[model samples]
Target: MNPIDRISRRINTLIQLPENKEVIFITDLRKEYRQDLKNFIFGETLAVKDGKIVIGKNLYKRWLQKIKTKGFDYDVKFI
Candidate 1:
């Protein structure tokens, strides 16, 4: 399969959380792929709920800060 299809397949495998439910948590923004988060169309805040996933502005900001500090250095498993 093509690379895009491969990535799509991998992403599809992760769409459902361990609970076997569609992931609605903002923490699900973490990705296994090392590609820039800004380029990811579906996993970012902007894509979730068409930008309605707002818990709080500070909450989102803190989330971003945590991600940056933790760094996207390892593959993320949805479990």
Candidate 2:
């Protein structure tokens, strides 16, 4: 599979699953990762809302953050 699918599946596997959910609260994340998640991941079909996965944060807030940190390093993941 491709990198996006690989990353998404890896993250999904880390979840408790079948009951418990996996939520990524981006409040504590650095500005760079947030922007990539908001722009690259969330902005694309890589993110689906049909599962027990939720990246908590408003789209507007994410956009504001991206603008605030414009030109920062992108293509980052939550390491």
Candidate 3:
């Protein structure tokens, strides 16, 4: 599967997003990245609103950390 698809699935498992919506919002992201760590997620996923990604939060922080460590291999540019 595509890397983005994997990320999407992971996010879905963490937080149930509306199936009808094509794009998730920054409002859906975790409080940390949504508020303070904004740059960490800027272009990692598709953006819909002002600067939100098409994803949500992860209480486990497992995939979130994986993304930060290995996201570059998936073409995610972190600054």
Worst 10 residues of 3 by lDDT: 70-79
Clash counts per candidate, in order, are 0, 0, 0
Span of ten consecutive residues with least summed lDDT in model 2: 13-22
Question: Which scores better on lDDT, 1 or 3?
Answer: 3
RMSD in order of candidates: 11.3, 11.4, 11.7
Best by lDDT: 3
Measured against the true structure, the TM-scores of the candidates, in listed sequence, are 0.27, 0.27, 0.28
Q: Summarize candidate 3's per-residue lDDT along 1-79 as a digit string, tens digits.
A: 7878876665564344444445556565444334433555455544356654445444224345654566422333222
Tens digits of per-residue lDDT for model 2, 1-79: 7888875664453332312433454433445445555553454333435552345434434544553567334554533
Model 1 — which ten-residue stretch has the worst lDDT? 33-42
Candidate 3, position 46, lDDT: 45
**Candidate 3 Cα errors over 4 Å, as ranges:** 1-21, 41-79
Residue 68 CA error for candidate 1 (Å)? 0.1
CA lDDT for candidate 3: 0.47
Better of 1 and 3 by TM-score: 3
Ranked by TM-score, the better of candidates 2 and 3 is: 3
